[model samples]
Target: MSRRNPSRNGKRSTLKDEGMQGDPHAISSSFSSIAVSPRTPKAAHRMGLDDETEDVELRLLGEDERQQAANGLDVEEQSGHSTHSLSNEDKRAMVLLCVLYLIQGVPLGLALGSIPFILREHLSYSQLATFALSGYPYSLKLLWSPIVDSVFFVSIGRRKSWIIPMQIIVGTIMLYLSLNVQVLMDDPSNHVTQLTFLFTSLVFFSATQDIAVDGWALTLLSPESLSYASTCQTIGLNTGFFASFTVFLAFNSEAFATKWGVPHLTLSAYLKFWFVMSYAVSFWLLFFKKEKKEPLSDVDMSIKAVYKTIWTICKLRHVQLLVIMHLFAKVGFAANEAATSLKMVEKGFLREDLAIAVLIDFPFQITGGWLAANWSRGDYPLRPWLFAFWPRIGFAIIATLIVYWFPKPPITMGFFVFLIIHTVVSSFTSTVQFVGISAFHTRISDPLIGGTYMTLLNTFTNLGGTWPKYFVLKGVDMFTVASCKLQDGGSELVVKATECVSDHGKAACAEIGGDCITETDGYYMVSGLCMAFGVAFLVLYIMPTARKLQGLPISAWRVKMSDS
Candidate 1:
């Protein structure tokens, strides 16, 4: 029988020497096999083979072998950190991360959900649309994301350095803004500009902080525990949003205003609450949170390389398709969302009533995230996303119809019930879609440059959700019913020839006998058009593209850019 030996390729050849099996020096040649240390230096010296340069042949394992070894280490490490079949570190990290995400949510909820309602009484829909641009930094965070990725404090931890400082700044601003909300609003002429400045700055800090938080997620949790990380995001974000939107808006209601002996819920109170929550997260992160230190080799600290990676990712054909879908996915909803509050206000719904809708939708949002995670696992991962796509289109269409034919009077019990159900169902499906896409993005993002890749994907989706509001809000005014002056230095009414006399600073027009009101027709027209585009996008781009890409390996999605 032939003796087994190391092959020319450097792999161990198959074992064939049965006679040598009992020899202590005989090597096991199975790929799954582990070898003991080379014959001790004593044995080599005894054999007169102990040249100083002929040290023990220590070869690095192949990539697959190395990966298997790493997996083993991960299992062992996880076991050591786990108790009662759950990882303590993972649970603790999840809780801490969720709190951090909730902190992020407070500002986001205000920007995306509450502020619109607060300003609706004063600003026209077009003016409201302009406010959405303040969040434009969220969509363009990718521009600075690479810098966040490439720079870090080694001692304080890469992600935490950014997170801690940004949190302090954001928290201080929130407190300062809260203290002067009334002062800022006192000048109705400068209200929009002041708000745009303050909130835009807030969002800038929030967006930059998000870059650090996201990068931290990569280092904080193992790949197997990533779903929990997503859970932290979805739940924490929704919770924070609920607090800011429904809870804060509830405070902003006339009931609260009457109780507090103020004209409206004091913005200072809300801001103070957010300030506390923001710093709580920051404090926890600074004092308690710890990151796993990776080797310097793992850190890519080059600004140029970071941007190059981002550009390369953007230029990928598959990613381009994903970006397009992301940019268009929420258009239908964006139009409705931009107009819903205004339409409801026109229907005499109070801020508290809208809070009820958010309240109804909150549970389903959390549930949808969990369901999306479970459904998107294993062999048919894309199935859940496809399922969500159809229902989303259906909801968009249905929501459009509701707006097109919304009743003139204050909402009835039946209509309110319908709105509740619709909010729940639509929020659930939308959340499902969001989580599915986010999970997909996470899966494909290179761990080597996670912050930039994830941020890019997320920013595109956010921009998609936001940019549509500009056109929708502007277009809705083009279909306005009343011709009159806007209140509180808001944008001029889109002057339509009408019976109402122009009267600035008052809701009522002299000729109309009551407050000048815009009809819901604009809501119908804008939403309908947006829905049509949404439907076309799903059929023409999303479905076909998803089909083509569904089962492809992650590596297959990689594009070879010239610069890359």
Candidate 2:
């Protein structure tokens, strides 16, 4: 005989039958039961369990636990299989998704990271500000993301329709740039606009490809493996960025090439190599890989309906708060992020050495992302993000100090070690903040409009970082007060280096035996201002708002759309 707990519908479940009375693993078994037996509306109604009852039960579970249970149920219902592990098909899809993301990262890496370093020597900061427009397409992709989501050739596949063509366009741009990149860089001051236009177009296509891949990822993996999509994206994009920036800089540098007994790789050669890779991957997707037909829930939405939904999402209060936050969140780090490395280079810290520091820091970035993912799976997902914010800003200030104290050319090994350590620490905090915020975004995004929703959030995040860069670069020159000193028979004359704004002016200055002396470096002022702004933002707004937002019920974040 066993005691039974009776339900409102007069249904009873005995402890003995459930193995809870005497089993040592009752807690674990209870969780298994909950995961395996999700409550449907019809079943709940039949059991006389109201919505209130369901809410009460849900409130008892932690957010992560609830998510896990929901994910498990989603998997079981969709695939009619155990939710313990991924199928081979799911694993294959993961690999394919990673490869696609890697392809997208190639041109983006060049535009964002490598090109600035390459152009810094020839172009003034003001000119570099114009070139930074190439990175804007990525941030502004949200404007057309809905169109990308809604319009597609059904026979060719929804995502594949955009991805394949976009990749091809990206490859073609790479090929075209391969022939002219050196020419553009050789006289960057005159051709900054041309280079900006080309890279902007390339990034435009790459951003569209990103929209497709993001949507495709939702359907590509089984629900059990859905969570891994972010991991794949982080890993793949970082790898491609590393290759284009660190590896390219290292091999392309004359000093590094000579030191390592390797031939210097030209930018054209690098671009050509990536172009081949891009074409191969794009063709493989076109001919060999097949897109799984999306479900009716995804396919039935019209372009108009999708756009309407996006508009509705934009209007939500929670979403509006998040968008505003994303738009301004990077203000604190803008100067440090955009100007520090370039300033270091201007101080004679070789680009090759900077690349090496980034190379050493890369592994820590990956590890930090992984660790942050784990830490974010708790009740307060944004805890890691908020916690890392101070340290990241602190490191930004430290970066300015490092740049200020940079040793003369041929930097000492000890100084290099110190630089590497600073880079790793700064990057680790950044990765943690990135991963934590991404996890929160994942938690809140509407699955019905998965691609558009995710893209909307991501666009703002990218914009937050991108929009400040141009201003920061421009501000460096604006705030700087420098003069060239020329000596004539021991009497020194100082002339403003306003004319030294271009490479030709610099050459002219040097030819006249004039030394450019900076009376006030704008880097220091901008760094200080950014740090102060970051601190103010953290204390006055971000901290309070984040705490309040994170405390909101999941339902508070959802939009209610009529099924008319």
Candidate 3:
């Protein structure tokens, strides 16, 4: 007769039914008997059981053991703490997510950074403003984020269903645009409608893909490993930016044409390459990558529930404050960013020079992200945001000074050195601030509605960073000493030169060429505006908010999902 043993769940099991328990050498075949109570209140309630009374069985010994072994988690209860360690699957997840993030950065770098320089000569300040506005979809992605969160093709994996299709659409658009690049470059004014249509569609599809990627990241990373999310984003996005901004520009640059035996590559060729890369990566992910098949309970896929969740997060007091801060934080930098490239080109800086400067500054951006992630982990987690904002404010002032005083025409070696230093320091400050802010957003965001919540906050942040560019571009004409409306019939020809006289006390405006005649009144105005806002932000928002929020628990922020 076999003896019976009682389980913690109050079920009696015979030794004969499971395995012989008395043999010292017999490893308990009742390993399957080991059960896990729900670690979360939501999970407990969803299953209609209390944490103490739940009978969750571990079905597969090998997989569970591998996870625990990889992460070094003890079977012994530790009361709600999970120390992060990278399993093989977690490593694969990071690589895939990082690559996807890099892909997202490509269009952004071109639309926001590179193309402005490419079209600088052909477009007016107002037209440039229109170009900048083409990126507005990024800031408004939250509106359709719910669809991304809820709708899915279960056959092709939940997130991939969104990501793969969007990538294909993006590639097709880029292919068409690439083929039309030369025609548009030849007659930009006439092609404005076509250019706007294609670019705008690109932005829309890219933003939708971003929503899916953000939601996918939530499913891919456990809470313990979440801090690394910002690092992945920083590195990956910057890498893509490097490709779009530096590599693309380098090939198109005069220096590369002069030195290399190879001819300068056309913008169309670059775009074709971009299309191929996007499609290749998408196809590889589609065939090779495997998303962990989670139960539907992992995410509340109900559309109503997602909207309700988004509303709840929005209503939280702390969340409101954070959103406002993010919205306002970059107001100082917005106009500065939009006008600087044009201004630099006007001052005789070549495309190659700016490309090289960005290349040199890239390493510092990666370092800043790494440091921010490590520093944000211990005591006073929010301290990095508070500390970083001040240096950035100072850098903004320095940048403003650079714009104001640099002499018109003939950029000297000394001036180039100054520009390089400014670029490096600015990149460092911006990266630190970005990493801190991103981590803060990730920490506060509920994984339950990751797509909507993250995009909502990012939209506000981008609004602060980008919208001011529209006004800055508009205002550039305000302090103009002279204006020339260049007509595109077959060649660049000045149709009319209005206000040919100097306004900002420059000598011989009609003689002195380029954007110097524009007088930088817009840049000066934005600089002063940023300084004022930075001071107010520091005294009114950051100081008090950081002091209050730094040491407190996450739940204290009032954004914690009740079920999660």
Error of model 1, residue 438, in angstroms: 2.1
Per-model CA lDDT versus the true structure: 0.60, 0.71, 0.59
Candidate 2 lDDT trough over 10 residues, lowest sum: 22-31
Ranking, lDDT, top scorer first: 2, 1, 3
Report the C-alpha lDDT of model 2 over 1-564, residue by residue, as the tens digit: 111112222111110011011000000000011111111222222211335435533453367645654554464334422446678998888799779877877777788888889888888888888988888888788788767766777777878888988988898888999998888888887798899999999888988888778767756765455556666676667777788888889998999999999999999999898889888988898889888764332133455655666776676666787888878888999998898888888888888988999989887777776777777764487898899999999899888888887788888898889989988888888877776676666555543334556667777887888898999888888998888889989899988887454466678688889977778987788888888988998898889888867765444444433332
Cα lDDT for residue 310, model 2?
70
Q: Largest lDDT belongs to which candidate?
A: 2
| Minimal lDDT window, size 10, model 1 | 23-32
The lDDT, on a scale of 0 to 1, for candidate 3 is 0.59
**Where is model 3 more than 4 Å wrong at Cα?**
1-87, 218-228, 260-263, 298-300, 407-410, 481-520, 549-552, 558-564
TM-score top scorer: 2
C-alpha lDDT of candidate 1 relative to the true structure:
0.60
- Among all windows of 10 consecutive residues in model 3, the one with the lowest summed lDDT is 20-29
